[model samples]
Target chain A: MKTLSYFLILAFSGGEHAGGGSPLDVNPGLILWTVVTFIFLLLILKKLAWKPILKSLNDRENLIKESLEKAEVARKEAEKLIAENKLNMQKSEEEAQKIIEQSRELAEKLKMQILEDSKKTANKMLEDAKAEIERKNAEAFNKLKEQVADIAITAAEKILKENLDKAKQINIVDKYLNEINKN
Target chain B: MYTGQELIGADTLKQVAETAKKTDTSWIMHDVLDANEIDLTPFGIIHLPHLNLFGFDISITKHVVFMWIAMLILIFVLKKVAKSYKSSLIPKGVTNLTETLILFVRDEIAKPTIGKGYENFLPYLLTVFFFILTCNFLGLIPYGSTATGNISVTATLATLSFLVIQIGGIWKNGFFGYFKGLLPHGIPAWLIPIMFVVELLGLFTKPFALAIRLFANMTAGHIVILALIGLIFILHTYVVVPISIAFALFIFLLEILVALIQAYIFTMLSSLFIGMAVHQEH
Candidate 1:
């Protein structure tokens, strides 16, 4: 390698003087140096620098992506839970309204039952009073009839004591009763 | 270009060597074009060893020194970021800069351009990006030569990518199939030979252009900045120095932009070439 490079350099530098010392002189040594240095740099830097740097960048990107996805999942779950709670709250309110409507119906039925019972009692009392009044009226009428019959017999005795015989008087009273019935 | 800077530097060396001679004057375009020496204008040339390890000149050039410097800076910065990764996923302080640039290259350059199986080519993409960028930045700082501006350096880089493109193509499509995919469908039988030649030429020209584009961009920006600064010397007046400095400063700022852009273009094109080879639809 050293002999190869030594000869290469002599040819380049020797050729420079021969070519009248132009600044555009091409040297084999500089070319060798450049190639060697670049390859060295590429190999060394690839292992030491780029590997970890790119890895860390990739890792950071993955981390951020995972965190964002987790946050999105959490947000969706929270929204679902809120919706469930709202639905439950609405369902309970509907049940409460239904119960109130049912109780009102029961109260109305009870009021109607109480009114019917009171009205029936009042009608029965009025009927009982009427029956009692009718019985009293019948009693008074019977008593009056007895009194009138007695008075009539006394009057007949005083006016015509020997005029009419006992059998005839009974017959005349029967006839009067028949006439009253016919009229 | 370093050549422009080295022009002034070379003559100064020549002037010192012949101190008994009359003073040297003025930078010529020829000097700027022909300078092939080390550039250390402020400091006298420090003679680096030119030992023959075997038959070649094993002497280090200014560009190589700067290349090594760029490499060290990269290793230092990246290793520091690597250390932070060991502790935590989140980067801190200067490590953030390293990671941000790395991710930008991966996401913006490699991932979209290479599409599926981008990870396999990531190390090469990252290396080329940071390497070219660091070399370009080193040029902007004081006393640092642009290694990427050197034709040989850029060519070496292109050659590596070319190997990856071909080898990957062969690996994916088999040797014959890889070559077969080079030709477009529905071409007449008579045109296949001509088309194949053109396609083969295109394969080489693509990477060739990649090399030249980076070398030319980096070299051109520096040359423009140097020329702007050299204007004061050319005009031989203190009056124009302020204006020259102003323009030079503007171009220097612009060079900074060009350096980064050139590095990005090099890496982006490399990934695209690799993708073409791997997919082989074109």
Candidate 2:
């Protein structure tokens, strides 16, 4: 089994130095070159590639963060504006309601004033008509009184001329007038 | 130092020498390293003249060349993305895709693991992730070698991670405090030494695993594919061709997933280690 294993190891390992020599053999020159090459690569890449790439990555990250923050701020501002607009709308609605109320009150007061003025005018007209009728009746009665007195005078003059003396006629007329006034 | 063909040729020469010696014929023998059936040496595909400096073998290998190509590709693509990123705030095309990867490393890996001090180590994590990913993917392409498959390369990366973890800890907590924090408080004095050793070993084991895991995973896929192809040559049969090719293709697809996963694992672990080191409270 040990011999077979050794044979297998040898066969699989490329039949005695197939891929290269003993894999353990270290070449000094290669080592030096690798070190120099790697260091050179490190220095060059550090200066040229990595710095810019890292910076750009960081910059992009910051930019994204800033933009997100700005968006958040803008959203807040919009919300505030909407709230303010809603408040203003409510305030305007209230003002419209108040104006409507005021106008309604004014209309009611005006209607009342007009009714009172018309009532006053109607009452004054009624009183004036009553006074005018009274004055007309009094004038008519005065005229009739004058007329009756004049007629009586005329009749007495006629009768006296026909059959009665002048002094008796004057006394009789006075008594008659007094009796008529008393009746 | 031995190329694959040279190694194979030496094997042939050795066989010839052995036969000749047995047959009582004159033959030349040269000392050579045992030739592996699959010579995995990262050399000899394209002859690059060796240049030495300070006693170090700096001869560029196939893996090194591929690594350079991967680096150039990464640089070009990332630079273009950087330009677009700089010019316009909105990411487009390649920039968009690359940004997703970058952000993943930062947010998922670095931030979650490293916490507050994630920023300091992010670049290193990003570099390691992209570099390893690029290297792993490049290997899948025809004629491309995986630099990450090399132990030396992975070891170097692991060492870097280890260094960062240590340095970050020391920097965050003073030197004495950092080492002191390794041992849990309220432990018995006798047991403290054992716990300290265990903790010290734990520190090394983490990076060691990082290196071995990446190196093995990356190399294993390539070996499987190579072995599958090698079956055709070994059997010398047309029947094996379709089977080998089909299996290789399957493994190749799986490798793409492994490539990304390994890169992620490396980066994630590195960050975790650094996070642990810097913030010892947790």
Candidate 3:
């Protein structure tokens, strides 16, 4: 029976371990209490701990996902704005260049026209001054000649008191001189 | 230093153990049988109250006290984490730790094992994991008791798991349908009775294994550590002291790993069982 008990102990742990108490000792009381305790613990934990924690975790996940999407949209918008700005700047620069080119051409044409007009007016003024001087010289020469003729006639009259034949001879001589001069 | 009769102290210990066994104190029996005594060593043992109801010994024992402590610690820490989450979703410190573990249970244990309708059983899985983990860790303390080391406690957990699997299956598949799903699609009628018995046995054994596995694993580690320390005294040799302490520490670290692994296993198995029931092909 002792040998059988030892075999039993090996097979089924019928004997106690270490000291007198075996950890495998069955207790109906403990089992009953444990069942009750575990159920209550589950209930209480499910309410206080599990519900709020899980909800918060889910909320955090959703919030993160949404934030990432919004960031992506904002980045795209910024890129578009930058592209538009570059395009506008390029267009305006071209227009400014065109305006500058047109104005330079206009300025060159106006300068050439002004120079030509001034040169023509200066030549005309010189011609008019020369003509006036020549006319004045001619008038003076003609007056002087008339005066000489009158002086000769007066002197001859004074020498011969009522000599019409002498005056007529002098006039015939002036005429002969005038004819020679004309020839 | 082989004093040939160094084992004489063992006989003395045996005498003391026998004397302890013979003591008329009502609580000693409860202590040995049900883990009714919480050994505080320096502070002295705490004997919980024993109660009888309808000829049933429904007493609150040491395991109960430890279990309550584990539960309270779980609630307190997780409650703080939950509250912290309200202000910001950014997890820091304890929240980070809890979040990592919580997600592990969900993604690793519940999701893969339970498959499509995994969300419903997350609460139970998470509870069991955290509760068992805390209980297992408690045993590592200087004089702390492992509630999970107790057979009754582990058995109770297994029973709850069994109930959940059954109830969830019944809810998904009607009573007869659930039972019918257990058998393969087309089988000989003679094989029905044999298959039924085997399947029924499979149901009970799965939970039974859970209970035994957790209890044995938890109890065995502490026992090994204790025995290693006791070796120095038993041999009456100073030579074994460092070796014994070193080995004990090693076992202690291993126990910590075992604690986490056991909790994961318990939760994983529960989820697997739940999946088996709810997601039957038939």
**Which candidate gets the maximum DockQ versus the true structure?**
3
User: Total clashes, candidate 2?
Assistant: 3
Give per-model CA RMSD: 11.4, 9.7, 7.4
TM-score of each: 0.69, 0.74, 0.78
**Candidate 3 docking classification:** acceptable
Q: What is the descending DockQ order?
A: 3, 1, 2
Instruction: State the TM-score of candidate 1 restricted to chain B.
Output: 0.85
Clashing pairs in 1: A6-B55, A6-B56, A7-B55, A7-B56, A10-B57, B1-B223
Per-residue alpha-carbon lDDT of model 2 for A6-62, expressed as tens digits? 445543443233334455678787788788888888898888888877888899889
What lDDT tens digits, residue by residue, belong to model 2 across residues B167-208?
999999999999999988789999988999999999999999
Residue B170's lDDT in candidate 3: 88
Cα lDDT for residue A159, model 3? 38
Report how far off residue B250 is in candidate 2 (Å): 4.8
- DockQ of all candidates, in order? 0.22, 0.21, 0.28
Give lDDT tens digits, candidate 3, residues B7-52: 5545554564565445323232233234556777688888878789
Residue pairs that clash (backbone atoms under 3 angstroms), model 2? A17-B38, A18-B38, A20-B40
